[model samples]
Target: MKAKLGMSPIAWWNDDLVELSDDVSLEECLRQSRSAGFTGMEMGRRFPSDPEVMLPILKEADVTLCGGWFSGTLVNEELAANKDRIEPMIELFRAVGAPCIVYGEVGRSIQGDRSAPLAQKARLDDDEMKAYARKLTEFGEWCAERGMPLSYHHHMAAVVETEDELDAFMNHSGAGIPLLLDVGHLVFGGGDAMRAIDKYHARINHVHVKDLRLDVINGLDRTKQSFLDAVALGAFTVPGDGSLDFEPLVKRLAEHGYEGWFVVEAEQDPKANPPLKMAEVGYKELMRIMTAAGYTVETQGFPRG
Candidate 1:
């Protein structure tokens, strides 16, 4: 299968935690990412909303726009209101030829709250999940009809966090709502990436190749520490620097015939773990695993799914 390697700008310039970000321009971020051998990058806070203005900067760096995060509120807000909020992103993604928009359900999310402990994360029972999933399916279908699809991101402190929650969400949702499997977040939340991949392979439209510092995660006091606190304590890292053995996961993806962008999205203090160094580590490790898994890694540009 054909796979493309991409990098998220979070590693260079974090949006949620600006303190963790490196002092760099968008051009420099793209330059460093391309230097590390990534052919594509996800949109970040620094990226211009206008595609006409953005395309030249990306072109100069020899990278394509892969995918980016969208803070979605479909769970708590009306469809019309959500539609209005997402219209600009939909137009931007469509204009840039991005594969899919990463829809992170941040309606009731505590991920950005530095004081909110991990234990206080939002939750929804079966009935609530059913309604939320239905709404997501409808929203996903609407986005697809407008020329892009939503890849639902099951995030760290979001509503659909653990394996059970993800299962419940997927069970209730239709094919219209595709999935974005973020392995690090899944594993950090006590979910097995291997098991998730086995079950949700068909629905997974995008992949985040995030790796974790298991020691940090294991040591964190979830009852006292928030998601951002865990991040500050160095909970996440690039592939080879972390505890995950990505070879097995990549092999599993290859077995499932997965073909899409595998974006390296390790957001940490750039001063501590320099973005360029970490990006190279992630790129090399993914390359080795992708080759081992029989994937032809695309170098020139990303393929539109």
Candidate 2:
């Protein structure tokens, strides 16, 4: 395994730098991210959206572009329209030399009706998933020509959320594609997060490390809201703040020879708690989790300005 640390310069709930409050400025985010010991970040929609615009700022901050998750209905949407969205994303990833772009599960939901089970509402459209998988294969091939990979995020909403769903989806898709195994997002479907990692060990290339609250998960299950909708409902946070046992999580990853960024993805009220303060807490938690798993790491804390 290569020696590298990964974290999301997650702007979703960053409490510092109001410029990143919505259209997160790269310059501002890089400063904060670098300060927090973040080696990289998941590019959001507002993150310059153009490599030409962000490349210089990234170099100045000495932060690598970890990659990003793109939101769109791949299985359900028309390929022509979907391509319009994917093409630019591919271009951006190419420019940054990112390994993959995290893509989501495809589904639609009713407004205010959050009582039905999500498993009932969200699912992988086999026929559609196959087509989209081929599209991704083509895209991956295109990226491969340039030495990149497509890490399709098997999100709770996407076709590959559950272990069973992932098994089936992988049977047909993901053969040549890499997958972003997000622990927090993966747990929503009640999937054994570690098992999923082991199953996709070969194809697993990137990660979005996060912790989840069982109470929050149960609450969202009661509402039956989609995964993205639940994000707005505050379902995720840094590992130690939640109930996940990251000890074995990291252990399992190590067993599989997993190497890459362990992107810290905590979408909480950063404004309520100062961003710098939250980062302090996050760094300690990551260290604790890593240590508990018996993995030794440099005792580095985010450099404070």
Candidate 3:
């Protein structure tokens, strides 16, 4: 199988926690990520929506627009409203030739609110999940028909936060709603990443290879601290520099014939853990794991000698 290496722009500049960001231009961000051996990058706030304006900057760095996040409100809103909101992003992703748009449910999410405790994350009973799943399926189908797919991201402080929530969502949702398997978030949310891979492998269309600092995760008082607080305490990191063992996960993914972009998406303070350096660590580790898993890593003019 073939796999591509991508990096998220959050490492350089966070959208939710602006204070954790590095003051850098979009060009510099792409250049640094490319220097770290990534051939693709997810869109960030600094990125211009106009493909005419964005494509050249990406081409200059020899980087592909792999994927990007979209804060969705499908949990409480109607499908029509969600459609209206996603239209522009769908057009942008289609123009950019991105694989998928990472759709994270933020209708009842407290991820951005540092004041809200982690335990206060939104919850959905089975009946509520059933309705939300139906809406998500319709939305995902709509996005896919438009030539841009939607990969549902089960986030840290969203409605579908824990393993049980994910199971509920997946059990109710159809094949139309594809999954974005964020290993770090799954692990941090007290979910078994391996079990999730085993169960949801067929639905997983994209991957986020974010590593976590277990010490920080364990130390966090979920009742008092919020998701952003945990982030501020250094709960996430790049692979090979943190607690995750990607070899098994990559091997499992390869075993299931999973192929596509494996993105490095650890969100941390750029000043404390420098995006470029952390990206390098993530890229190298993914390279090793992908090789061991018999994956041919795609090179979009990267690792140049």
Supply candidate 2's per-residue lDDT for 189: 70
TM-score sort, best first: 1, 3, 2
lDDT of 3 at 108: 90
lDDT of each: 0.93, 0.64, 0.91
Clash list (residue pairs), candidate 2: 6-261, 7-263, 105-158, 114-223
**Model 2 TM-score (2 dp):** 0.80
Using lDDT as the measure, which candidate wins?
Answer: 1
lDDT of 3 by residue, 146-261 (tens): 99989999999999989999999999999999999999999999999999999999999999999999999999899999999999888998899999998999899999989999
Q: Is candidate 1 or candidate 2 better by lDDT?
A: 1
lDDT of 1 at 249: 94
The candidate, 1 or 3, that scores higher on lDDT is 1
User: What's the C-alpha lDDT at position 94 in model 1?
Assistant: 91
Q: If scored against the real structure, what TM-score would every candidate get? A: 0.98, 0.80, 0.98
Q: Cα RMSD (Å) between model 2 and the true structure? A: 4.7
Instruction: Give the least accurate 10-residue stretch of model 1, judged by summed lDDT.
Output: 296-305
